[model samples]
Target: MIWIFIFFMNIGIDIRTLMDARYSGVSLYTLELVQALCRYGSKNNYRLFCNAFRSRDGRPPRFDYPNVSVTDTKYPNKLLNYGYFKIGKRPKLDRLLKTDVFFMPHINFVAFSRGARYVVTVHDLSFLRYPYFFTLRQNLWHRALNVKKLLQHAAAVIAVSEHTKRDVIELCRIPEKKVHVIYSGINERYHPLSAESSEARRVRSAYALPERFMLYLGNIEPRKNIESIIEAYSLYRKKNPQSDVKLVIAGSSAWKHGVVHAVARASGFFADIHFLDYVAEADKTALYSLAELFVFPSFYEGFGFPPLEAAACGTPVITSNVAALPEIAGGFALLIDPHNVAGLSEAINEVLNDKNLQQNMRERGLNHEQKFSWEKCAREVVKVFENLNSIY
Candidate 1:
């Protein structure tokens, strides 16, 4: 008698982002997705591939689960990144773990075996859209990746938002059917907090936070439209001199951050504007909850996680109408043109003056936030994998 054994499909993930200590939008997405998959995906085997040398602590994130396993190598990121793009040589990921399907959590993909199918997540085409905002090296690296070719070859493409999906279709000319829109979610730690809450008071004292302040929390970069935000804040202060509310800009400096600083320093209310460099993750929820208003007038975003996080905390938001921001925070936020400093300033003034509007926005924002969750996103992603696995 002959007997055959059936095995679960092995799903290999590129978890380089998770290995890095700093958590950006992409890193956060990777962390949340992995946790969600571990929680709900018991039927499949997950092999998390990491470059331990690239990590600050030189260790991969630990996941104590039966179905998940961590695989690490001492190879540095620069060597692998160059080898893949420059020499067209990729690491033999499939042979290492017998991977059936390799999932890249971000656009960066390392070479794998031909036997294994692959999927990649495109967070945004910011480099393509705002070329001037990036450095020469950054632009060259993005161009070298040949995103068009990557999208064409992948078995499936995961877009973090419908706006990003449309960009994939239009910019890369990829088939609409091949691209999937999976909205990212805010962490459960983000929630509405009472003004008198002990946690809020602690965070406030720790950060030297003002009683009433407008918050802008994210990387201080050129594409974030911080220059416009500063200009608008100046106009707001000029228009409403009696308004004692401060503007608190939190987050680490990125490319062209000096321009933002210069603009802020030139503002008439420079003393009222605070630049808190890189707030800890533990303090983010309190920062959002305590803010009178959260302003995110970004020129473009793949999914706009900050606005969603702010809404989840029941903070009224004012985001730009362009890109995914409109879809993510339309009804909940006062959408305005990012380039229009006067218009943005007027909106800020109006929101500050109207308590009823603020209350309505808070309620609407919290309700809007209910539509997104990491578990729901993970299920949808796993379904895509199952469908592709069955077909290919």
Candidate 2:
């Protein structure tokens, strides 16, 4: 009877990331995973752990299912992190709740889990790879955590892309077999839209967007290579002086965003560039659909989601060939060297001018987007959990 109870134990999830009102890459991943797990893995019990004090809305994370429960604490994040990392003290998660396995959607974990096994999801190793791009505090936070030790101790590690898995193996020297490559899924609402659609027109009017514009969506961060995009856009305009196409950059500014704005302001065609900061989620698909072409020349990504989302909306993409971009967008979107301003500018011009190529890419992108779904991602993740159960 005791063995049977142990075999069918509850799973605890660290959902502290979801406490934020605005969803970043990791927050979206956590939200989608939790929703999918509740929908598909209803047979198993889940306990969602969150720091209620950190929640943007000051409300506990919501899970509407009989098999799921929420556990909230008012503990501050800074103190908790200090105790976990600096003091080497682990939280008594198993004592507070009878969970057999605890899964952290991100690298930040409660130092100890008593008897519960741990699984962590590593989105990217950007901080280690591009140290100069991150802020001093960001670098210090990662350094304090000792990510290599965390990866080594985890029972299983989930990598969002094959590129990230390889990086983990090479950089952290973690065993290859312990890391699982699970692709993130696009939301169902991101399907292709017609320019004449009501929602599309409404979004255009609301944002005052130009009719024919190239789009770049994501945070204005150093790693995003927004400065390169600005320069490339300037070059594109210079090469086609007669063209009336605009460049639309969406998303809030982050670390060192002044560089991007400075480049754009210095351009001869500064008026042709538009900045719509932090677009709402409901407007994203329509924004993608209305674009003449989507461009993402990022320096690095664990898995590039914006390009994938744009592709799902039937927009032709021109993305970087480096990192996971090629693996994710190859054969569907035009790939270019992110560091080469001339090459990126040329690719953008070529895609925008070629009607036949655009049609072909649209078809291929829609087909490729079909390969990723949250339900499928959830099923694969549950399999990992079940596999861990067999071992324990």
Candidate 3:
């Protein structure tokens, strides 16, 4: 039997569900991967670990599964940020559990107890690539030197996209052979909504959605290129005088500061735009289902999830040609230069005017959507675990 351990070092479900949704991607990915692997029926016993502050909320960090058991960095010794490292009065967890292999869903620098194999997943190098886009503290935390150490210590590295794998090799100077590219999988819940009458109305009415409005779903951050999307929408509105166009921006705010409020007041088209600070998983399907078209003009993404989610919901997508957007969109949606406001406006106009193009995009989205599945991702992960354990 293969014995394995997984560590959710930073965040957990409770935090993601309640605290913030921007960081939900990694937590959700870990849950889905674990679920899929459990269902795979491998002769593997899995142990999961995490860290939590204040045990008084009075819940165990452990999630029950048929073949999996979980634990947390015992209370009174939580991980606290110091000047440089997570300097605590006492060591936290310190990889106390014994397992054949250890899988870290995201980067964590904590030293293991002893003699445990390590696998680290690097979702994106945006922390390194777009250093200026982040705060002074985040940049210091995710420095290039820190990432290089993580890469060097890992037995295997998981990159969420090919673009990220390239970044790892170029930025961290890690060899190509050591990197493995694994695409993030969306839940089966994102599939095209069936012909249920209430499903359509509920989703539409909840958002007060326009009969013909475009969607841009993701956190409102600088790297997301929200300003450019708003500009293109404004330009499109100006050109199409009679067209009743609206842009919907959905997702929780990361910084939640003055930028968005400033954009809303300064952009003369405030009535034509909407920004929701939060959207639940169930509501997300409805949001995508009701969208006339979905657009993601992110300046950079390790692997863009909004486009993939929209495609799964049968909404026509228009994303930038940069990073892994093309790799995921794959001729299914209109590709535009993220920096070109006019190009974005034209692409949006073309998609709306051409019925044939819309129908074709819908069909291609269904096909492209098939290329990703949690089952496949889990199988690949299992293979990695098995391969590593076989050495013993």
- Sort every candidate by TM-score, greatest first: 1, 2, 3
**Which residue pairs in candidate 2 collide?**
90-112
Name the top TM-score candidate. Answer: 1
Backbone clashes in model 1, listed as residue pairs: none
Instruction: Give the range of the ten consecutive residues with the poorest summed lDDT in model 2.
Output: 1-10
lDDT of every predicted structure (CA atoms): 0.88, 0.87, 0.72
108 Cα displacement, candidate 3 (Å):
2.9
Tens-digit lDDT track of model 1 for 73-107? 77777877777767888678877867888888898
Error of 3 at 48 (Å): 0.8
Best by lDDT: 1
After superposition, candidate 1 runs with Cα above 4 Å error: 1-7, 54-59, 85-89
RMSD of 1: 2.3
Worst 10 residues of 1 by lDDT: 52-61
lDDT of 3 at 384: 65
lDDT tens digits by residue: candidate 3, 367-390: 888788888887787776666666
| lDDT value, residue 153 of candidate 3 | 68
